[model samples]
Target: MSTLTDRYVWAAVRSIPEKQRGELEPELRGLIADTTDAQREKGVSDADIERATLLELGDPVRLAAGYTERPLQLIGPRYYLDWLRLLKLLLVIVVPIAALGAALGRLLSGGDVGDVFGALFVTAIGVAVHLSFWVTLVFALVERGGVQRIKTPGDGPLLEWTPDSLPQLPAPAARRQSLVELILGLVFLAVFAGWFVWQQFNSFLTDADGTPIPVLEPALWSGWMYWFLGLIVLEGVFAVWVYQRGRMTMGLATLNLFMNIAFTVPAVWLLLTGQLINQEFLDAIPDTDADFDTAMSYALPVIAFIVIGVAVWDVIDGYIKAWRSRNVSDTAGE
Candidate 1:
């Protein structure tokens, strides 16, 4: 047993943007309440009034279409270029990484040529599907809910529907996103993620005799790796932000300071616990004078000190750049 009101609301909003849903839902409820009240005052049965009110509102799909632009199209013209650019960007980042992974997996498993090609094809298709689904979803939402910016008041509320009015080029230098920086950041993220996954799921690199040597201590896998991985992700965010803004803002600088401190603490723990280098790895060094503990006791602390110093410098660097940029802006304004 379902109320006409509940069914209508769900149907209407199922296509709405998530952010707009809350506001739209309340407005819809208010409208329904008012309509139902008027019908009740006319001495109509509750069930009959509800049906009549809903019927007046008409099909939910058509009603919802009124709320958002391009309801029928997967992606509207306004968002099509951005959608295409993002799709290309995703393919650029993901395809190579997926191809590399497939090739490496095949090589490690001693796969034949046919198997290698098959794996590559499978991975490429999988990556493209994943990229397409997400990118299309985001662009469809944009078509529904994204702002229609008008640089001039002469322009109509809805853009004068024309391909010529669509944005052709990017913003000017210093304001535009850095393509080189973005590509580098993406490449770094891809490499880091791939390496971390390898560390988590597979054995370490093998020696000449195919002996699987472990690079990290067993202690690391317990919990510290998560902390390290989190910092890497945080750093990746900073990288992306830099690419987006073409420079760091005061907010980003502040975050950098906090992240540096947060990252350093766990890193220091790894060094202090002698978990920085595996004991077996230390032993593998031919004619090593110092044992695992001995080497760690002296060398590890120096490395830790260097790491801390570098982190402090990074914090200082971020703040200095932020301050300089702020000062430049203030001076230019004057």
Candidate 2:
């Protein structure tokens, strides 16, 4: 037999069970040989005959499936839609919950921003992988076992399909908005809260002895920083609340406005009162022509302006989202 014929026969039988391969390989080689002889008799060249024979047989994997009576796919058409729906449902429900749990655990364990985020990513991926593996395994078993519909003691077929069984889907735009808001809120809060603690132990600015020097006043740790951290936690909780609700409402938006004010007012006040930055750390600067006090006198107003501007934008954005959500609801109702 030609080398091409040998390769084709080998590829087709390679995946068949060992006991079956003994029978299938000889059968496959016979078919290839018979086809090659017929084509050669029709005045085809050896290379052309081999190519034509293999092409007629099509993909080796599919041919193997035919010989073995086994599916090439993990979940066949019978269970594919069901498996897909279940996987989507599990991912949407489980991933966020896993992320939240990981984030909270890391926070309570005194993890910094990097540690908390790393935990969230690793946990989400692990949960997703496990969910996919188990779900696929169960569906593959069902497909192989030739099970039709699962039934319960006092119920109709558990996997039966009906119009009434379809889920009421939320508005896609609103759902996406809520998710974005939740993610951004949680990330912002986590970074600031973690940074507040992390800065004390790690900094780019170091003393002459190479000790870390924090930019924020260490005195704030004794009192004001706790309040800021509390607000950060509250913001995180509010982010979850917004996502769970799936759309902004007037009441929720109002609450968001107040939360922004609560955070930014104190922040601006601290900046203006010269209570935010560490004077000692500034004095430790190696070489600078500009005076620290003169620089801060100009810098504080700009920082205050940026802070107030962000708070104002946040408030307005909340109201706008709430208004748009209300309008969408009204239109849907009508």
Best by lDDT: 2
**Candidate 2, 194-260: lDDT as tens digits:** 9999988888788879999998999887656876897789888888987765667676777777667
Model 1, runs deviating above 4 Å: 1-179, 199-211, 291-296
lDDT of 1: 0.63
Off by over 4 Å in 2: 1-169
Model 1 misses residue 300 by how many Å? 1.2
Candidate 1 structure, TM-score to reference: 0.43
lDDT (Cα, 0-100) at 321 in candidate 2: 81
Q: Give the TM-scores of the predictions, in the order they appear.
A: 0.43, 0.48
Candidate 2 versus the native: TM-score? 0.48
- For residues 16-105, what per-residue lDDT tens digits would candidate 1 score against the true structure? 777877877777778778887887888889657876666556555445656664345446644554566568766756675675578558
